[model samples]
Target: MPAEDILRIEGVSMQFTGGAGLFGRRNRTTVRAVDEVNLSVRKGETLGLVGESGCGKTTLGRCILRAHKPSHGRILYRRDDGTEVDLAALSRAQLRPLRTEIRTVFQDPNSSLNPRMTVQQIVGEPLVVNGLARGSEVADRVADTLRRCGLRPELMRRYPHAFSGGERQRIGIARALVTQPRLVVADEAVSALDVSVRSQILNLLEDLQEELDLTYVFISHDLSVIQHLCDRVAVMYLGRIVEEAETEDLFEQPRHPYTEALLRSVPRPDPRLRRRDDVLPAGEVPAPDEAFAGCRFQPRCRYAEDICAREEPATLPRCHFAEDLTLDGVYATDVRQTS
Candidate 1:
């Protein structure tokens, strides 16, 4: 691990086992949510993980947070004391002490937040659980956090139902930050908000990041938002990262075919910048159990060839096509690019 890298995931894979029927008949199928993924997050930097729904972005984030036990490999968390611990191997008791150092702000505020608890209790619970403060001390801390998150201190007595989507999200942020976590996995934190509110939340997140010197694993399917907020971006397809590069490098010159397709599909903010309508590949995304031998994307890739069908292409090094393909108003032209 580099000195600057605070978190590292090595060959992390997660699979879920399911049962079918009332008799608890076991289903033999294994859904590989995250497969042999490797990533690192530098201290105080935001790494955006973007992919379509069911592409394993959320699962990867959860695995890092130890919300899901990884089936294979390890997640290493480096502490300020210059020591590293494998989060995957930690027992619940061992992990309890580290919980305050890492936290998650889920996509749905209503579902993630405790509906039964008042805002004050919800935010102050972390302090109590971590033994950081008690009674009046916790209340004061919660009130301070609420104010920092832009929530009214008086609203601490209210329930989540009384808040708007944006307000609820603010409450979620307050709860997550009240623990004074060093790393936060924000899984599509603003995806459900209205367009106007989205930017406000984004700005707020940026401000919080600066104030806290936080490291983030920001997950979303929105490239525009990712491009704006993330220092670097990783594009995942079918449980594998197809490309990982700096944000500007990615948007200016995407290397992977799947990444190019995704970039082309982004809706233009200005009408004048909109180009011709591009082609969308036919057929649905492949099933997780399909047993693919080569590249999982060959079925839907426009530039797929014999090699793509017979062998998986290494995500490194770029490929080129002789002709340009219009994909959802973005032009994909032949070019040799590198990370």
Candidate 2:
């Protein structure tokens, strides 16, 4: 635990075991949604978690928020008082007091916000639940947070239905910030917004981060947004991080074939910059039941070797040929590229 690092995750794995059959008890299999994930978030920095859907980015995010108890490994979180706690190991009673320090801004405000609750109640719930404020104090804090999120304090008495989509998203942000959380896991925070409104939300997030000195784990499938907002990006595939690096470096000089394929998938603004049809392999991500003996990506990798199917790579950019292959990223070659 460096003083600058606010949180660290070591070998964290999350699994869901369920039974299947006619009565749903004959056969059981464990689906590891997240596996051996290790990461660090420095104070005031935004780290982006990116992958196709079902790649376990959101599961990992929820694990950090302690919304899910990880089946294995530790989630080491540093509190503002210079004390350290393993969030994974904390009991509910012990974790309750620290909930104010960690929060999540969920995607889809339409579903996340309770329709029955007023704006003030929705935003102030964290404060009330955490015993941080009572009655008028909650309203005051909620008002200020709403104002910071570009919502009118006067609107606090209104219900979620009264606000537009963008305004509702702002309300969601207000809810996350009202507690003055040091670590905020924004799971697909702006993906549901319209393109125009998305930029507004991004700008608001950036401004708030600067003002509050907040650390963020921003999860999204939108690479353009990730490239724009993240200081660093972690590319996940099959419940594991294949590559993690500074945003610019990862986008410009991707070391893994999976990363290169991801970069190629990003739609280019110019027709000339578009990727060719045959450059990368064409295959779907593996299903949860499609167990791999070695590298999880071998099923979809065009450059996979025999050893790749027999042994997993041991490092970040989890590819046996990462050092040998000259992969292309967004910045490396705008035109079509071959591995």
Candidate 3:
């Protein structure tokens, strides 16, 4: 692992077993929510995890934060002091101290924040719980955090119900940042807001990352948001990372067929330029418990051949024709213009 990497996910996988009957033989099915995945997150970069819903983007993020324990593999996290530890192996007691260093901004602000608690209490709870501050000191810290998130310090006394969707999201950001975390997992952080408000929140997050020197694992299905905010992008499909590259590189020249299809699905502003036949692969995602021998995407991939269905492809550059295929990407027009 590189010394500069703050988080390393090595062969991580999460499995859940279900389907037992009340008075029958044990016939459980194992669902691999996250299959053997390896990823490296640098100290101060935003890594975007993008995929369709149920593609395990959220599951992977949860595994990194230790909210959901991986059934297999190691999650190595390097602390701000340069101490490396396996977060996946840590017990609840052992992981408590590190919680302040890794925080999460959940998808739904309404459910994340306690409606009964005022903004001050919601944001200050972490400080009080961690024994980071006391009494007036906690209040002061909460006010500072609120201000930093573009919220008024005076609003700290009000309940979350009084705030707008964007304001509530800012409050959520304040809560995540109040502990002064080194890494923040923003799981669909701005997907619930208005288009106008989304930009404002995105800009705020960018500014905060600069000011705080924060590393982010931004999880979202929205490719546009990922393009706007992430430095690198990792495409997930069926509990595995299909492709990963720098944002520009992935947008300009996608390697995997799944990645190409995802990029093609992104809507362009010009209606005339949109192609009617630019549809994604047919059929829904396969069931998590349904075991398959060959490539999981072969069933839907237009480029699938006999070899694709008979042999399982390696996770890294899974496609047999990855090296040879000249897949279409968003930069085709730009390349043409330049030429």
Candidate 4:
């Protein structure tokens, strides 16, 4: 049976304006940060979003949380109250209450945390701002939430700078979880930590999800981490989702050429298992501002053929065990086509 979906993103697109005015005329360029992206997250499940830098993984996460309004498409959110809301359609005033239902934990903890605020104050801010608690109640809730996030009581009185990368991330998690949100978007939450600490934070996140029955959208560029933490994975490339499938299925049999390339790029731990003879593709990632005629990856893709230069490929259903697919006798590809 299929899991119940708690969030649905349909045909979403985001664009940012760049460049300045020249001689009273604006030299405007549009950066398509996210383009026609679609996905659904099952209730109480962790959906890992993986992509290279500038692939729109973070952008998609923010859009789901209503932090970034979509220029096109809808974000349908199934609230805990059994009500459905088109988050992308709601105005700031209309969406205020729903904000508490979805929270974000950014990549960098230090930048996200306030240096002047103590741990208690930082974690309690959400509860107080949302009017869920006050005065002593706020402190109590903060302390309890901290404990849930694996923070000691003594650390609650200290500032964010006083903590390690893992601890600071825990504080960030504490702040997001204190609101008791139904959905949390962790954008590269564990990327900045040391490998050892990253594992601890991932475990803590998993534990919290199980304990609270919370849903997560975990975004990262690390395939190895996603392989372990995600139930399903979405791969993004150039502001689009290239492929999405169950974690094990994706790693074991990636059909998309881009996904295959990405997996091949990962360093094999055992030297005996390494594919040193395989040719690594070269060329820089294309500028987001430039529009592609067909597939965005054609320039660097070794398998790209004439059809790839003239038409964008749709993500079609393929055999789970097959890495190669026929596109007029050519291959189609992603990290995402997160995206």
lDDT (tens digit, per residue) of candidate 3 on 214-287: 99999998999999999999999889898899999999999998888888888777644653244368787888
Model 4 spans > 4 angstroms off: 1-3, 24-26, 276-279, 316-339
Q: What is the number of residue pairs that collide in model 2?
A: 0
Quote each prediction's TM-score: 0.90, 0.96, 0.96, 0.91
Error of 4 at 86 (Å): 0.7
The whole-model C-alpha lDDT of candidate 2 against the native structure comes to 0.90
Cα deviation at 133, candidate 2, in Å, is 1.3
Candidate 3 achieves a global lDDT of 0.90
lDDT accuracy of residue 162 in candidate 3: 99
lDDT of 1 by residue, 1-339 (tens): 889999999999999865675676766678898988988999999999998899999999988889899999899999879899999999889999899999989898879889899999999998998899997999899999999888889879989999999999999999999988999999999998999899989999999999989998999998888988999998888888877889887787776777777887776555445432333455788887667777888788777778767777554422333134322213433343444
lDDT accuracy of residue 249 in candidate 1: 76
Pick the winner on TM-score between candidates 1 and 3: 3
* Higher-lDDT candidate of 1 and 4: 1
> Model 2, which residues run further than 4 Å from truth?
23-25, 332-339
Which wins on TM-score, candidate 2 or candidate 4?
2
Note the clash tally of each candidate.
3, 0, 0, 13
RMSD of each: 4.8, 2.5, 2.9, 5.9
Worst 10 residues of 3 by lDDT: 330-339
Using alpha carbons, what is the TM-score of model 3? Answer: 0.96
